[model samples]
Target: MASAKPKFPAIKPGGSLILAWQVKGKHVVVVGGGEVAAGRIVHCLNADAVVTVVCPTSGLNPEVAFRVSEGQVKHTDRNFEQSDLDDADMVLVAIDDPAASTAIWKLCKERRIPANIADVPPECDFYFGSVHRDGPLQIMVSTNGKGPRLAASIRKFIAKQLPSNAGNAINSIGNLRVKLRSIAPDPAESRKRMAWMTKVSDTFSWEEMCKLTDEDMDFLLRYYPENKAPSFSELRIAQGAPDPQGVDPFDGSFGFSVGA
Candidate 1:
């Protein structure tokens, strides 16, 4: 039989493709210790990257200096050297010296390593979008280096519209999924679990999902194979929650959904 033909049109090439890069345990060399560099270092550290900051002691900002003093980041008390990029998985240049920054960008190009030269969109291989983080959930808004302020405003708006317990809901669901996997380890059980989880998701509101406890997860594990998993509302009622009243906070009618 012939394979299915493509249904969608080819994408036009204008916007940048957003991605969640995994940099955990990777080495990120940041050249400069100014405020911008300090912010960049924090972002890298948040992702569990090994970070090195290179700059003269005089150039160190208070934020960077504090981290360096506590030995959170390795600091080279001098200008950037070519050897700084030796084991670097990525580089971020935040110095005011145009010549030095450009030279580093060129070296990164030669080594085919991704680099971001602060405030220089053309010299950067990646752009840092305004990020809104909630536990394991992250929403990033980017304008492809055009308008950072606008991107930040948009991210703020997006964040404001989400339910406060959104992250908790995600965490509970994730744990439930882990329990489901353990209960149904067979590969053939994949579809069955997926359908059950989807049903549970569609049936429960985010607030209801967030209230799920280990007992709820245990109940799911026991009944998932039997295709009789209980709705989260039932579990909540059993736990003395008043009968659910009013509209769900996440019913896609709270001015949050596209074209709502």
Candidate 2:
């Protein structure tokens, strides 16, 4: 017997546009209580948004209950209400009830609020992309509502390539920039000095960069370009290896009919 083939779509996602919303001190509302809703609530909390979950109380997931207990989220023990969306920066409707979810979507549209509905891409005003966050560095990946699991797998790959001390390494380099500005205020000369800073920073391991004191950073800024590259005794030290983990790139093994 021959295997069935896949159908390809001629059209693709429109394009990629990226923006970071400043959610700190803002309110975010989620209208569901299951795993999907709980996941969105956690993301809002991470962004420092005051989160409120509005749904029937009896079906709340364990994660939601835990977040409420920890004071990270507020739970309103009732169905979603339009008034709940007041002052909201964003809304997520994860419930399966199409009529209710549609009502929420219309309300958000009227209020000009960005909204996302789990498992229902056509109704979404935006998507929750896979996010890789390191202290001040954030990478967001989106497959344009096509393959969220694939997006998540790619995010894990990119995030793992960064050194563990990346945050501190960036701070060390930043301080050097400030010092250069103080010493060489002239624009053209400062550009050349900035190039040297970039080159010297690229030569060291992020761990070694983090270990450098302000004195070491100053030394590098002073003698770099004139001096040869720093020795790798500290820079090249192998801090042992990390445990390997299997990576799954595919979304699923479950069988579903395309012509159903």
Query: Best by TM-score, which number?
Result: 1
Cα lDDT, model 1, residue 139 = 90
Candidate 1 accuracy as TM-score: 0.84
Tell me the deviation in Å of residue 132 in model 2: 1.9
lDDT of 2 at 15: 64
Span of 10 residues, lowest total lDDT, candidate 1:
251-260
Off by over 4 Å in 1: 1-13, 228-230, 238-260
Segments in model 2 whose C-alpha atoms lie over 4 Å from true places? 1-13, 174-213, 221-260
Against the true structure, candidate 2 reaches a TM-score of 0.68
Model 1 gets an lDDT of 0.83
Q: Which digits, one per residue and each the tens of the lDDT, describe model 1 over residues 1-260? A: 99998999988888988888899999999999998999899889988899999999999999999999999899999999899989999999999999989999999999999999999889999899999888888898988878999999999999999888678889989998888888678999799989988877877777788777777767545546556545665544433456566544345333322111
Tens digits of per-residue lDDT, candidate 2, 73-187, equal: 8889899887998888899999979988888888899999999878877778878889988776678999887898999999999988878766777787778778867766778
